[model samples]
Target: MKRLISTLMIFAFALALFGECALVFEKYTTDTRIKPITREMIAAQIRIEEKLSEQTTVNTGEPHKSTPSRQDNGAWMLTLVNDKNPLPDAYKPILKSLSNGLQFDRRAIEQLNSMLSDARAQGLSPVVCSA
Candidate 1:
């Protein structure tokens, strides 16, 4: 009987504590006041969306001609060359030697020469340490 009374007292205390917490939460909790959207605001949003759509359509009409992948005998600038995506065994880039005896891909030779020339003109001694 004593055990049953003590268990009931504990349960009642837990219930009272839960009720007190519920009251405190209700007192502190507040409903967020949402400002209703006006018709003018909706119209403005629609106009902005229309302008964005127009700009996107205008920009997308002209398709960009990008360099083809390795399959098309062309090299992609962002080609992934890792263990999983290794270059083909027969793949070789045409190399050109720079004035400093450094070799690089023939396609990049013009840009590399231009950069080196510019650096030299600026009195900056740029050396090609590595390809």
Candidate 2:
């Protein structure tokens, strides 16, 4: 009888240990779903963040140079135009007509003409292929 009681006590202890482990495992398990990420998604997210950062203003004690509201008086030179910084809808650059019947930004016309003249003088036969 004594030996039988000892055997039953050991079985009960083993069962309790196994039950506790099962409870612990279940408690730690997660049911949340994880989605896979792609390179294009990361690139697009980065581009969006960069554009948002460009539009946001930083608070500095000193006065900061503000972006020009209009692209006038050669202000376009200092303006940044890229994937992150886009041209304003109201911006209309000054246009000038070239001798070759081409229109370009007035600010750049002088430099473009100078370069063409120099190339011609050097006998390079420079041609305006595309604007």
Candidate 3:
């Protein structure tokens, strides 16, 4: 009977602590006064940002053409791959495996190694989990 009572007491204490933590989390993480944003508001913000970016862009008086085979410098790093700007179906990146068994693009392997070396020099145990 005593054991059961003590177990019940512990369970009740844990439940109360969880509830208190949830309440505290909600109190600090949420603001109820702000109105929900509409799609029009987001679209307007995007337009404003686009206008700002266009104003800041400097044109070098040459039409920009995408080059595929040039991997000399970090020029290839500007290639953007996303859902809207998907890579060519036949496109394949030259991958180089690191010492820790993770593979990354060969073009940026030097930069990646330099970053890892810098991290290690700063006494950080930086392990590349994925490439």
Candidate 4:
């Protein structure tokens, strides 16, 4: 009986501590006029915060992407299976389109286009492909 009573006492203290923590958190987020609060309300808010944190971490891919599974630069990199006989110059417009919305020269595009054309003439997939 004494052991059971002691366990109950500890449980009650733990509940009190949890309630205090909720009150403290609410005090920080709300005005002092919060005269009353329910334990359920505090528990709900804690659950919401935990869910949001989990979602943010999962969506950002920080911990997972940091793993060196494949060779890559910091920025998302793509590999082309085929630049479709895109003359080396062919890629220039795309590259330029990328740079300042294509304000750059078109010769680069022509070179890429020619290179792609030559590669395709060899019966290879010189096409624009992405990883």
lDDT tens digits by residue: candidate 2, 1-131: 99999999999999999999999887667535644689989999999999999789676778755564545576657877764566877978888888787788988899999999999999898878665
Give TM per candidate. 0.40, 0.41, 0.44, 0.24
- Please give the distance, in angstroms, between residue 73's alpha carbon in candidate 4 and its true position after superposition: 70
TM-score comparison, 2 vs 4, better candidate: 2
Q: How would the candidate models be sorted by lDDT, starting from the highest?
A: 3, 1, 2, 4
Candidate 1: which pairs clash? none
The true-versus-predicted C-alpha distance at residue 105 of model 1, in Å, is 0.4
What's the lDDT of the predicted structure labeled candidate 1? Answer: 0.82
Which candidate, 1 or 2, would have the higher lDDT against the true structure?
A: 1
lDDT of 3 at 43: 100
Which residue ranges in model 2 land beyond 4 Å of their true spot?
1-75
lDDT of 4 by residue, 3-122 (tens): 999999999999999999999988788976656779998999999999998887655555432222333464323423233422333433323542224333343566666776799899
In candidate 3, stretches whose alpha carbon ends up further than 4 angstroms from where it belongs are: 1-74
Please state the error at residue 44 of candidate 1 in Å: 46
Off by over 4 Å in 4: 32-131
- Model 1, stretches more than 4 Å misplaced? 1-75
Backbone clashes in each candidate structure, one number apiece? Answer: 0, 0, 0, 31
For each candidate, the alpha-carbon lDDT, in order, equals: 0.82, 0.81, 0.87, 0.62
